[model samples]
Target: MKGIRAKLSTLLLTLLLLVPTMANAHTVSTTGPSPDLRSALGRLLGEHAILAVVAMQKGIDGAPDFRKAANALNQNTDDLTVAIASVYGKDGAAAFKTIWSSHIGYFVDYVKATAAKDEAGTKKAIADLEAYRMEQAKFFADANPYFDESIIASELKHHIDHLLSAFNNYANKNYTAAYKDAQTAYTHMFATGDALAAGIAKQFPSQYSDASSTNPASDLRSALEQKLGEHALLAVFAMQKGIDGKADFADIAASLNRNTDDITAAVASMYGKEAGEAFKTIWSSHIGYFVDYVKAMAAKDEAAAAKAVHQLEQYRMEQAKFFAGAIPSLSEQTLAEGLKMHIGHLLDAFNAYVAKDYAKAYADVRTAYSHMFPTGAALAAGIAAQFPEQFHTANTSSVPSVQKVWFQVKSNLLTIDGSKTTMDTMPFVNQGTTYIPLRYLAEGIGAKVVWDASDDSVWIIAGENKAEFWLGADFMEMNGQRIEIGDPIIMKDNRTQVPVRFIAALFGWDVRYNTTDWSITLTKAMAMEASSNHH
Candidate 1:
């Protein structure tokens, strides 16, 4: 057992030093819009990465403040489950929590085993973690075919290895190695999160229809949403750490302040320098109020805490008025009510944290974080309404029935009608014409596709419109009239390929080809009205 343990430790440490750093970097454009799905997932997953390290460190140290770390981890779990529920429903989220929490338990077991110097127990814990890696890999792989099982399994192994190596190093008093591994582990999770989120978004595009939020036109809104939401999360975390007198309180507080700087810069980019500075002043004041409340609570000064709470209420009104003044469309009363909710949630979270009601405190943290999204949206909408020309092209129509198709070059994967579809033959560009599989295109456009092998012909029927084309035929019979299409129908990989433009013209749908991105967008004629109005 000792030999095996030594070998495993040596292997992990070698891998730790050898593993290439992952670049999980993302640039948030203050002038563009991004998909809300990415923003929300990034925040949740990033928080998970940070909280997991904090929890593990505290637990391994056997610190009295471990409870706070544990509570933060629980809060992150709750947030993750909520995010999963948003896409996969409540039952799916419950299943996710079970599988996810099991791995955390395995880590705890490993920590215990190490502390006791029990080699056999440590081996058992590692074996359990290996089992968990496969289980989680299968879960995500089965959830979306795009998430290849082998790839997921490999990545999960990396995650487990990094965590184990970090803990092992820490146990051996290799402080430098432990910290390095922990940082790598934390960074790796961001990539894992991006992959998972992209899979989920591709699997159910309808749920993430606001993909245009990341586009350059809506960058301001997306940036603000991320910055503001992170502020709420980090502020709550910092306040809790401060109340508990945790060692990382100063670092967490600085992070919260950095988020404020990011948000101020976002505002400045949109509203102007003066407005940004003013907004920063107002924002920083509220944070100070929260700090005052935390300090007062720490000292058990009831009167001081009450005074701080009153000041926060006044600050909320000031913030509401400021936002309302900036955006004429925004009602001051509505803003005040929203600000009140924000203040209430933050205060409640802090109060709950101080009282050791961790569950309630974390619940409030989720509430506060989620609340910022709508606030950002409202602010963005108001800005867009005021300056329509700047945001007109970025605004996507809120057409509930409209279907979107994103065709990528050399890829069989396509998002058809807001759902991912895999085709046997990929869409390709031959010369100047783009050819797509006839069957997939027809079905994607809500048309009935039928192939008659006897005549080597394909039939496309859509509500009183009928078109028939034969393989290798240059002309198609549309409603009994022969129309000469310059491009011949060809077979690619046993699938009949047709010119997208010809088929779109036959159905009276709009076809747009983007050469830069190699994407083709098809929108039904009926949906065009809503899209035009959106601009």
Candidate 2:
């Protein structure tokens, strides 16, 4: 175990450290009016917020990594300047750089004042920021018609407030509030990115060639980027909090759980409920494994650390497989490689922090954060390709939503939304309950049933809801709550049979039983139609 841990740690450190730093490492779309520009701006802007927050915290603590964090933030600023140049030209970039760079200095002034316990200096710094906000808002407003100076100024103020609150809370040892504010500050930039990009795209529709910045596909990309990038950043912070034995470790963990829930919801919205449940389990396990590694390191338990690494190795392949199945364009091998890099980034960063290499630790944090942009791009493209109508700019066609399912007791025939099929095992009456083949009924209602061979359990997912029960178990678990099922699942004709009414009710499907013929009918509006209607 010691040898394995050493080797794994060494590999991560080597890969992360040897990678060259690029100034503008976002997806560049040189061709006119591309949504890719929106993604790029979002990445750079969001990166700026996270880096700024981290640097401010480091500044307050006088941490060894303070200079490195500041430098990284500057580099992000440079990237943003270059991104502006691409759209508006060098003169405009220079104007943006001057206005943007001054605000950062004001933030630094506030940090220094707080560190010195100079109340007046802090007030003066705030006044300077208040003034800078107007100048910055005017710069954007003058450049684009869509930007209202007052609204932009207000947004900038919120950004400043969140960052200052985060730093002040950190300086006062209010770590939980500090981290929460930090996360908000980080997320706030993405909105700014969207607004800025949308305005720019509108300002120069010819350059973007009529591509809408807020198109469905582009929105999907930005969402995935935000969630995945935020995951990496939050994971790094949680690991830091854990290692330091900070009181806010639980808060950070809760934040990570919330992020996971969001990612799960995104997947469920696009793929289905089963995929979402599976993704949640898989994604959450990697986080748990990282926690295990952190705990093992604190305890100086090399074997435990190695075991955690082993679990993470398994997680990479499992996660890759899940993505490969969900997105046909993503190959298992390729996804595993990408996940390996992600895991490596977290592990390497954690190890660097433990060794007091704070600079490298923060650098790895930036690297890990930036790496998710292309990943989000890949996923967005794949999803759009898989469901063309969902991403179509013009809504001229639609999917035939499944809405009804029919089954009869002791009959192998099944009807799903007017389409008939034969089930391998027919539904039967046991005592007072009607039992049906679990998989057949689940699929018939547009829900999915997944079997876990390792535990002899079955999972049912309907829309955003998921339930799991082991074969012959008299209980089922849904969203972490256990419920009693009086009738246990059993095998009939070599098929898993579950109570019909219970399954239907769990999925919010209306159930009808004809006493004359003993036919069972399940009805529900499928997600596709619901989404179309809402849209």
Candidate 3:
């Protein structure tokens, strides 16, 4: 329970850090880009590119991880929807999702057609995507009058071209061209985010302020976060390319090396030349350790992998000590713990990638990327403290409070515990009961689901209670006694589906069926009691 809470806290804190603080209208204006809005859009748009590449790659290969990749993409869409909602409200977000998701579906269709070698199907999918681009462009242009429809549509067409080129190149086995296109597509999304965010900021001047003029420190911190985080992302990508012996392996690795130099130079600017050199050596050594681990895994050398892990542990200690020595405010213990987490997330992401667990891999990628910002923030804060003259102004920005909302398919939106999430597979009514994805629902409620393939059974362990059920079975064993459900366990679209009401009842949650909105809300009994008490 402690571990779960800690994990949730970390997730929440990372999210809070990414949100830009609302600024007053009277604040001094800047002519250039808005740093706050850029930071927010960069994260989302960057992630969209990353996930899209992963999905396309996995889809073409017919890999099991494709489902996970798609799910991660859906989650990214949810985040984008929330970001849109923050500015334009719920209806606007819903409208955006409708168009955005259609494009994703079209991409999926394209991939499927490619896999089947159906040229006509592929052409149809491409045509659908072209139509989707126009719709999306119009959606944005209509929502925000700051941008011209013709210009937005032209840009959208370019974005579509980049993605389609990447996919087509991959389908043709043109690895070098494919990767180059992917990189271009990835980079282009940042520009998209920046432009869109600028439009929003201009439209809502009171709600959005440029961080450069008001809070240079936060702006600087965001810049550091972007560079350092991108280093981790590119390093991982380079390693994967290396492992696959891709034609562009050298180019990608060179990119990663350049990122290292960039970070080192950034450090040198803040610290001294000697300290920067020291930091460069230490930082690059960890990347070397990761390479060693990857090589060991490729060779199926467990002992070598273990040795690499041990070396990384030592590297963490040395890195922590270096930070502690440089910054008086950062304690060794705290730094060490944070470094361990950083190392763990990176290793986990790498391992998941190797194991073909695309979902976990991308999730870890997000976690690892997010973890770096705090490292940057801590180091920046220490520098600011040490050289108060250089950073005279204090950061007065406050974390934005988030409201959790709930979602329904093609209907009005709702909320759960003030949080909103999207599922690829929507809940549906089967006979008299509603069915939802078992793993998603269970995990959302902080439960673990273990599948026994030999027996086609699922064991859901939530807290102290255990529930067991076999696929196509009408009976579920909960804590010992067997209870009958109206619908049997079933599988749809490779996802396990179970009756929502039955699972909620067994899990001690109150289930409310919203007929008007066509949504189902599940609240834990304890949470409901707490809510009532507060009221």
Candidate 4:
């Protein structure tokens, strides 16, 4: 999701680009928690082009951690660019990258100048960046420019000037102005970007089109929207922006739980009710697992962490299958790219948590959960084509998918106590004190239960479905699955009871477990579960 957010940041030119990822709108006024402009710009730059370029130049100029810094900045930029290319079309992003890369170079010079205390270098970098502004401004101007080039350019200049000043202040140890300047500078940049994208899409017919933008049909947009609608994210954002506060209350894209059900709705709209509901049920499960992760993190419970990770892995596998099976347009590679964005966001958010950067961690969390909306809606729409009745009840116009996912994720994670999610194939159903092979039950709940050795059983929990029961020889029941254990729980090398057929039939469809090779084969669906979530 961090990867997705970074990539999504590249989509627009201005508003989001110049600020923090998705933190609240704060001011120096101290009304509430708000980041001043400069800090916001630093955050944007950290992920986008500006910092990438500057860090390189700084490294080149003998900054102590120049190369290391460059690597960090570029790493972020690379992820961001890949994410953009995934959605905006590599060719289009290719064009943007070409232009974007050059600007970064220019910023590097600016940083070098500040380091040397060289007035001329500073002036030159400033001039070069200004030129970049002009060229980029014109590129966007060719598309839309928002207002007349002259007027918009004036605003752009003011914004840039403020940015330069902030940079200077930061260099000079003038923290106050530096923060102030940073805010103005980044916000200006965001404005320019927004204008640029809007102008380009609206104005240029032959080039710079808005084909795969924030609309509903394509997987690209679907994935992006999901990120936008995360729990209390868009809601909090909108609340901060006062969009939810508006009269008539037509659209509530950025608030908490005001009703985000777009993905299901979209799916239902396109397909039918049953499919939408299925998507929702599956989607909701993942949210619950993420919530579990947060809980584990807060409690510092290693056992809880392991359990959450296992569950998340299972959920990913199932979700992958859901996409592969349901979406006609998605290939395994396509699904990976889509899933990768979410995974990246999750990893990034967790990394922040581990690093104690609460602001960034939350920002990444917001993007990860919120971004799921579009995909959820699209899934719903597709489902609508299959089941119409439920689709109508879960219509397109609602809280938004990301928000719902957020709600679900938050609720589950916050409340997790000590639930264990076993990945064993041969589940022991305590029937008259005797255990039995519980393939019917494990497979019923979408888990690939495996028997290890000696006496232990490992259930490969895949997908969002969940259940619990002690398998027995006579009868077993867990999560709506009723079965009789026929085979005795055999002991393998070290683990325990091995249920070969049951788990193989159930989760094997998604993830194939080769007992002979002692390996787990992931189908296109199962392959989707290899996400490095925040632990």
- The number of clashing residue pairs in model 2 is 2
List of clashing residue pairs for candidate 3: 404-418, 404-419, 405-415, 405-419, 406-414, 406-415
How much lDDT does candidate 4 score?
A: 0.40
Alpha-carbon deviation at 41 in model 4, angstroms: 17
State the lDDT at 83 in candidate 3.
Answer: 86
Instruction: Work out the TM-score per prediction.
Output: 0.55, 0.66, 0.60, 0.32
Q: Candidate 3 on 377-488: residue-level lDDT in tens?
A: 6765675566554344332334332222234534323344465456667666564456676676555434577889999988776454456778898666544334444347
Flag regions of model 2 displaced more than 4 Å.
1-33, 172-174, 396-535
Model 1 per-residue lDDT tens digits across residues 307-364: 9999999998999988899889999999999999998989998888677776677668
Best by TM-score: 2
Off by over 4 Å in 3: 1-37, 115-122, 169-177, 209-219, 237-251, 269-276, 321-333, 353-358, 377-535
User: Which candidate model has the greater TM-score, 2 or 4?
Assistant: 2
Residue 285 displacement in candidate 1 (angstroms): 1.3
TM-score of 4: 0.32
Residue range 223-268, candidate 2, lDDT tens digits = 7788899899889978987988876789778878877887786676
Q: What number of backbone clashes does candidate 4 have, counting pairs of residues 3 or more apart or in separate chains? A: 97
Off by over 4 Å in 1: 1-47, 50-54, 57-98, 110-131, 149-201, 204-222, 384-387, 394-535
Model 4 segments more than 4 A misplaced = 1-147, 150-195, 201-260, 331-341, 344-348, 355-535
Give the CA lDDT, 0 to 100, for residue 261 in model 3.
71
Arranged by lDDT with the best first, the candidates are 2, 1, 3, 4
